[model samples]
Target chain A: MAARLARAPGISLQHSIRHAAILLVAGRYRDTDRSALCRLHDQLPQPRATAWWGAAPLTDVHDPVTIAEGDDPVPQLRRLDRDLLRGARASEPDWLPDEPPNAWRGKGDHGQGGKGMMGGVPYGRPMAMMGEEMRDGLMLDAMTVTIGPFLRTLPPGLSLELTLQGDVIQQARVATPAYSASGIASEPLLRAARILELLGLPDLARRARISAARGDDDEGLVAAARRRGALLALPADLADVRARLDAALRRGAAPDPGEECLVDRLAGMEWQSALLRVASFDPATLSRIAPAAEPEEGEEEKAA
Target chain B: MTAADLAFYVLSAVAVVSGWRVFRTDSMVRASFLLMLSFIAVAAIMLMLAAPYIGMATVFMMAVEMMVMALFMVMFMMNPAGLNPMSMVHQNRLSIGAAATAFVGLTVAVLFTDLPHEKVARQAPVIRDLGHELLGPSMLVFESAGVTLLAAMVASVVLSARSGRFGPSDEGSRPPGLEPGGEPAGRVPESEQEDE
Candidate 1:
């Protein structure tokens, strides 16, 4: 469904909320995802509206624009965008409260809140502390961050806790496993298109999607992608990812599930490369490789 | 004051203020970019001073350097977005002392030193002269340095490749063969050939 939206004319899907003017909520979300969804809604800039496509509107949303299942959402989305811009439709209010997550507690002259240079939490969050480097022996600041349940790059509902040093991931743990794959999501052409998009070939990705929708073999699409150096854009070091991309382009069967843990595979890779590696796998294979870690106390309340 | 003099004063203020903000900004990424702005302002002043080549070169070089620096800052710094607002500097007192000393020394030199007052002729081909100066006698040195830098870039790429000449770098890697059920493409170690 998301892939179809990406292909729709005049409907560009944005990775960041800041870039988007309308929040399109499609498909069912978990009950726990409510706060996160609300946060996302609030992040969208002013003159924004929410269009629920085949999905129930959030309880907080006022007079939501709902699209029925089996109907094309493109027209409605375009109308909503147009209406909002024209000021004919009312802009949606923020679902979440406008307040800082932590209290400001600075005591110093510059509001540093700590003695000397690095003593206390300036706001509420503690400064990133040093950790033993993964690649080198030197100790460097390592940041542990929760990435997504809805990040465009990763599969839906797949959230990860990544400890990073420099751009490289020192460690990774799956906070939540990805939702089960729908038949359309597992299509080879769509999978290949996703990889092409990641490789910075959006035109080729669009062609691949069009071909998939038309039930075309897409031999020309594959050839065009190759001519454009789609394969070359990928790092040679990530030969596995390259192979998966090739296989997907050729409409080959999915790769046999490996015994290696997903977290182990991801560690030591830079963030971009790691995302590419993760995107290379089918959802079933990914779920097999990355079992969810036991949820920590109060972790449910935290949204990235 | 003349327009040129007024422009110079404004640019000087921008350079100094932005340079100071480089330290004051909580975000390391923002700091690197503020430093770039300061460099650009100084470059603009250099242009006003009639050194086009130096000014343009400063802008180009600082743009690239600051971009890389910003990337590094995002990669290494904790809370690179400054969501928590933390100090980026360490050994603050020592840094302040050194900076103050350098400022004083530079200010004294600018104020007291005997400086050339001769203005460059308005029609003088300054950039052309600089080009000749760089590419004439020191051409070989510059060319050699360029080649060496290129070589270093290639060497780094080769060294960082996960797959080595011998075989796959890890258990998961499966390098494709030239033909179906054939030996893998690229150079294979003699030991592997013997085992096969």
Candidate 2:
């Protein structure tokens, strides 16, 4: 009977993952306690990479280096890369660095970019010397590694926390950052609300977006619900929505009758097809926002 | 009173007291001690009956055996050497009922039995004559018994011990750097080592 009691896995008393993590590290607790803690830990949502330093392009000639390049005496940089691969291996796994590795060059203007890179620096080595104007042009051509590309595809408004087991992501904890008062897209609810609005749920989408735009992402569902109620209180119609979108799109310039007619025709199309059209616009829009410049000088060509 | 009767009464009293203590004591160690006492008492009682060969043997053998048992009780079961509660009888009412029934049945059988009162065939004590008898024709049997007992002791000690706390016997001479205390010089005590 004592043995039986000893063996019984106790119910989890730890309500939070933080506490469970503490228990896991301490490991002084009984099997019952540990079991409860483990269950609690497992129950915690997997974390997302809220912001990621995206993939660095690899290269053979100059190994990619990711560090700032100012002229001041550099403080000793901590060695971050453990067992960094010296050369290519026989069996190259997919997760391993890509072959014919595109060495990361700093953010450059589209097509003018020379190599694969994270942030603005070539990961491991300085760029080959180019003429002054060409160097500036090369610098401007390097790409900004946005975490947004991977993030945009995830289910919106899901709260996410991430953990890395070595280089690989071991766990992700999803939780809506609904309580942030900044109304920033950082919160899942506002982000979700924004996405919904971007997808064109005008009335439903506008409530959170307006609150978020007003920098109040902390607005609770009840307050958001109340705001939604108020919006609903307005005398709304399809014409009102079209009028509003037209007014917004027209702010920068006078409306072209031909473009307006095309917009109207597209607006009337099925929601599904419209969604595909909107998604198709993403790459072009992203490129427009953060343009990549073309490579200015070819080192090999110059040397020849 | 005869030595047998005196011994019987003393052992019976011990058995009853220890049996009572086994239930009364809250500590597991105490309860086990009481149990050991009872077994030893029973062995004594067995010796008291003209069963000298078995009786004295049982006393000497069981005493040594039970002392080792006491050491075990001190070592392994948590709070070794401390009086920790260890009541195996969890279902008190059920156990009481079962035990009472058994006691009553056994008491009735003992009280009603027509026990024989046998007369001794020998006038003198048996030990002297038995020794003579054994040395003459049964010396081999005596020697075999001694051998058997030696083997049993060796086996029991081996079985009870954990593997190799002594490690391997260093070659007849100590290995390169072992000191007089059979350990490396400047070695921290085991307790301190565990702390680090």
Task: Report the C-alpha displacement of residue B142, candidate 1, in angstroms.
Answer: 8.2
Q: Which pairs of residues clash in candidate 1, taking residues 3 or more apart in a chain or in different chains? A: A107-A113
Candidate 1 segments whose C-alpha is farther than 4 A from its true place: A105-116, A182-186, A292-304, B4-51, B58-119, B127-196
lDDT of 1 by residue, A155-212 (tens): 6667889999878999999877766654553367777776887888888887777777
lDDT of 2 by residue, B26-125 (tens): 5556667688788778877765555566667766776776677766654434323222223445788998899999999999999999988785454457
C-alpha DockQ for predicted model 2: 0.00
Q: Which lDDT tens digits does candidate 1 get at residues B28-49?
A: 8889999999999999999999
Model-by-model DockQ, in order: 0.13, 0.00
How far does residue B25 in candidate 2 sit from its true spot (Å)?
Answer: 2.4
TM-score of every model? Answer: 0.73, 0.25
Top model by DockQ, which number?
1
User: What lDDT does candidate 1 reach at residue A89?
Assistant: 96
Q: What interface RMSD, in Å and to 1 decimal, does model 2 have? A: 32.6
